[model samples]
Target chain A: DAGITQSPRHKVTETGTPVTLRCHQTENHRYMYWYRQDPGHGLRLIHYSYGVKDTDKGEVSDGYSVSRSKTEDFLLTLESATSSQTSVYFCAISESNQGREQYFGPGTRLTVT
Target chain B: AQTVTQSQPEMSVQEAETVTLSCTYDTSESDYYLFWYKQPPSRQMILVIRQEAYKQQNATENRFSVNFQKAAKSFSLKISDSQLGDAAMYFCAYRSARNQGGKLIFGQGTELSVKP
Candidate 1:
């Protein structure tokens, strides 16, 4: 797990509730990414940031949103959590956005009931 | 669209033996990169090995190596001297050389079990 850290490693929440996961990095990497892992789907990108206040949608960005306000903090928010959104979320940082070597955090396991 | 395929869903190898995991990718782009990632029970995605499409030489890292065939669009991971700690889910990924956000496309994944 590189120098990245994610809060609330495990959480059990109710459906329709809102949730926000935080990813903090000690390394001043320029790129940050948010991904989700499920049983069948290996891992799908939810969102990514190139710099502070810059973010973009991924393949599965429908029910999720992300924000990066500083060099070390990237946040993922689920405005309205759903059962389908329950999955293991991972945060990664890379020095370059060219898809170079990315260091991942431990991961946050969110469960929606 | 680029796609990665890991044919083997599950694989077993004996301790101290060797095993190979196959991965094939479909892409029209000529320049890109291929990588092998390991996700153990701890659930952290670790970079196992990487190979650049332009590089002809195979990439080797300690106990892990990769056989990259650009012509056939194939990249396989070979683990030598397997250990029980090697048991984990391995994922094959592809990244285009373009500046198109640099998103990684991953295969379904193959679960590797090391039998002691």
Candidate 2:
């Protein structure tokens, strides 16, 4: 409820297909992050952005890419999606400075067939 | 690399009872923060409590409190008089204070069930 929204709350795509998930925030936070949640493996970071056009790969950045063109919009793309990529994705935003409280939006559940 | 560990996978507590969830972290940085997040069936992540490493006093919010032992690298959440609404997947997270940017290392999570 931190003015964050994830588009395509539920998606189904086939293997080898391209998919892009969008995270939009209204808080104008400077930091945005994308994460994937799987059973037995909490939430694993995929990519994060500190500012417009500034992005960094996370621990599980392989096979995934992200772009932040505006303060509110952060995009995550899975090129040639694989079945292993099927999982629930979450978007988080943090205000500048301490960035202590990272408010999360409702997750997006994606399925790769 | 920093790591958060939640040794308990599942826990159940009767309504109005007290429950404690254990979490331990491994980090070299002396300045950091710990947090407890709750995710219910709705799949929304909710922040329950937070503790700063530099703060010696435990943090409490309503019926939720944290026993943060910085020297022991242990952080535990105690829910008093648990309610059915408290049932959720609880996650322990660690964030380093060295970097101002947002990055959280999360534990696997502990599913807490509040029985009627």
Candidate 1 per-residue lDDT, tens place, B21-116, comes to 999999999999899999999898999998989899999999999999999999999999999999999999998889756778889999999999
Off by over 4 Å in 2: A97-99
Which candidate comes out best when scored by lDDT? Answer: 2
iRMS, all models:
1.2, 1.7
Measured on C-alpha atoms, candidate 2 has an lDDT of: 0.93
lDDT of each: 0.92, 0.93
TM-scores of all models? 0.97, 0.98
Q: Identify the runs in model 1 with alpha carbons over 4 angstroms from their true place.
A: none
Best-matching candidate per DockQ: 1
Tens digit per residue, CA lDDT, model 2, B13-77: 99999999999999988998899999999999999999989999999999999999998999999
Q: Write the per-residue lDDT of candidate 1 for residues A13-100, one digit (tens) a residue.
A: 9999999999999999988999899876788889999899999998899989999999999999999999999899999888885648
Output per-candidate TM-scores for chain A, rounded to 2 decimals: 0.96, 0.97
